[model samples]
Target: MRDDMDKVIVERPRRGGSWQGDGRAWRNSKEAGSHLGMKRGYHRTKWLNENLAPLKRWLHKQVHRPWDKVYAELCSGIDRRSTVQAHIFEHIDDFVERGAVMRDGQVWVSASWWGRGGRAPLEEASHVELFVHPLTGILLPNRRLREARAAQRTRHGTWAERRGDKPCAVYHVIDENTQWHRVDGCWFEVTLAKFPERVDAAKREEKRYDVLRRCMVTHGGAGRRPAPDMPTHASLYGRNDVYAANKRQLGRREVRARLGDDA
Candidate 1:
């Protein structure tokens, strides 16, 4: 292998751009003593054969471990005092190309290895790939992952966004009901049985956008709004097809009787 590494398989192109011709043919044809560049050329060729060629070949042949294993190993080896580990962990994706398939709680490496190998199993794997830590099972949200989640949230809008002001003030009405709340672009659904308890819980947390409150006060007639901001009653409540269908089925008289005349 060392002898093979020392051998120069490809020669530099000659001045006229022909690889068949020797680069140093003209110089070598001259008297040996007259070849001023021979020493530099010899050392350069030696360095390339000894160091660079082998490195390039090795890099081309190198096979990376599965992403989950790589992540687990990296996290296991983390040391707060080591700058190298910190840098590697910070740009972990750069070291490995991730391609995985997760099903039935098992993660399988799908592709992206340089050398041939069978699919590997990942321990402690999440049922779905992306953003999940391999070992700890904690979600590590990346920009793409976050963007995808945001798109999903927008496409299917949360229960709160879908419900809008249909049930009146959601914060007031659903305060004691188990319903979803969209906060900071993420949704959390919790069950509460009392209004005061929900108020106390909200007070203890960081302030978040009150989407339900804004919708209620602005469109549900709890407060006056500018003409531009005010949407028609049908527009506000009819956005949900299921609710609209149910409302239509109930008829105005039945709806009024069940939900009161204001409904």
Candidate 2:
């Protein structure tokens, strides 16, 4: 790369001088501009264009090969955060569009119908082919699958309201085998299930003061002065540092006792 730097033509000197015909002499001249300023900028841009750009272009070409071949030859051996891996994931759609990625020939079905093998086998049933991101192995859904998911949301919301439950928010719980959806305080596995008895038991055990505090904070409590150590709703929901500290204080006596024993 440094050897290529000599090839860049610097801004010509205003004062005429005989050609030294040497890279170092040209670089050292005042008209090449100060090393700290335009000279450094010129060298950096030239080196990048001459060396880095071509290398990146070559890497992209390598990525355009069939995913399995590319993975076996390149991605599998590299760290997930490596530039090559990042490039593959960032341009995943490009690979799919170009037919460089493999298609499993599987259609994406609604999560509600996923555990049932698939939705109804009718000829007009809504199902769309699923595409896989070769490098990250993430499934990308097609238009019909996306529409099905939207329709499912509408159905769930209507059902919850009809059952007299306040539709607060949607939450997802993903595990190795399944993804559970929770809406309006009801948990559904695969499809809508009865609100679990275990959740009711847990809710019954919640402290009255804690429940009251949450209610106040969530419902226009911002105008009032907050408790000295109260965590904001954003922190609580985000499970950030403030939430971690609040959690530590939840069973402070137990924690202190454990720490004393360790000491």
Candidate 3:
């Protein structure tokens, strides 16, 4: 009963609403009207022709029960949802919410003729199979399961992966805030506070340098005058607050030269 393990989800075969309705309709066709045993106006013959008769033969072989007997039992509520009731329906929701069913002795699901008892994980699925508590039925964690869950909850990806590589345009800032972040190829809703911590401070410096290089190109090379409307190298650096505390690192002369002010 280690706390580290998570219970695997139980998956039942999918059966849509039409299947449920058809099965219920088939059952109603057998009821009689009057004195609770008399024939009702069920249009029994038309119902047989349109619905039950079409599948009667196939169901006979599938369930290995004579069609008449099965139909009688269905009318008596022996099978509530289909030609054969699916075994998983009885406990699927319970098992799903509770997360685990007892293994070996107390397992409630059983295979039905029409479908499997439960789904099996595909060959490529990454899963952890671990022991359960004999009395309380709690899952016991292995080393792999614990580590995998830990990484999944705590480790996020780089900033470039979380957001796009380029800076979002100022015009799109409102729309951008509503957008989601991507981590490990899955999109997740992230808060503004958590967003800033995805990358280290060094990565932010690198991004500023890259944007400055792009601005240099747009300025038409170092020491050349930019048009009045175009953003200058000085503007890009100042707006990004690049190295504000340590401006002396690059020296005033080199900064002016790079900004094209030396010309």
Considering every candidate listed, which one attains the maximal lDDT?
1
- For every candidate, C-alpha RMSD to the true structure in Å: 23.3, 23.2, 23.3
Q: Model 2, range 84-165, lDDT digits (tens) per residue?
A: 3343344333323212132354332323223244333111123333334445554333434434544545555566477885
Stretches of candidate 2 above 4 Å error?
1-66, 69-75, 78-116, 119-141, 158-163, 167-263
Report the number of the highest-TM-score candidate: 2
lDDT of 3: 0.30
Candidate 1, residues 142-200, lDDT tens digits: the string is: 32323344455667676756778343322112332334333443333433221122335
TM-score of each: 0.18, 0.20, 0.19
After superposition, the stretches of candidate 1 with alpha carbons farther than 4 Å from their true spots are: 1-97, 100-141, 159-263
Q: Arrange candidates, best TM-score first.
A: 2, 3, 1
Q: Cα lDDT of model 2 overall?
A: 0.35
Error of 2 at 27 (Å): 79
lDDT of 3 by residue, 1-263 (tens): 11211111112233332222223444455563324422223233221112222233322232433334543443353234543333323432222112334555542222222234562221111133232333454433222433444343345544543675643321111132222222232332321111122245444322221221323231123233334323443443322222111111233454345333321
lDDT (Cα atoms) of all candidates against the true structure? 0.35, 0.35, 0.30
Order of quality (lDDT): 1, 2, 3
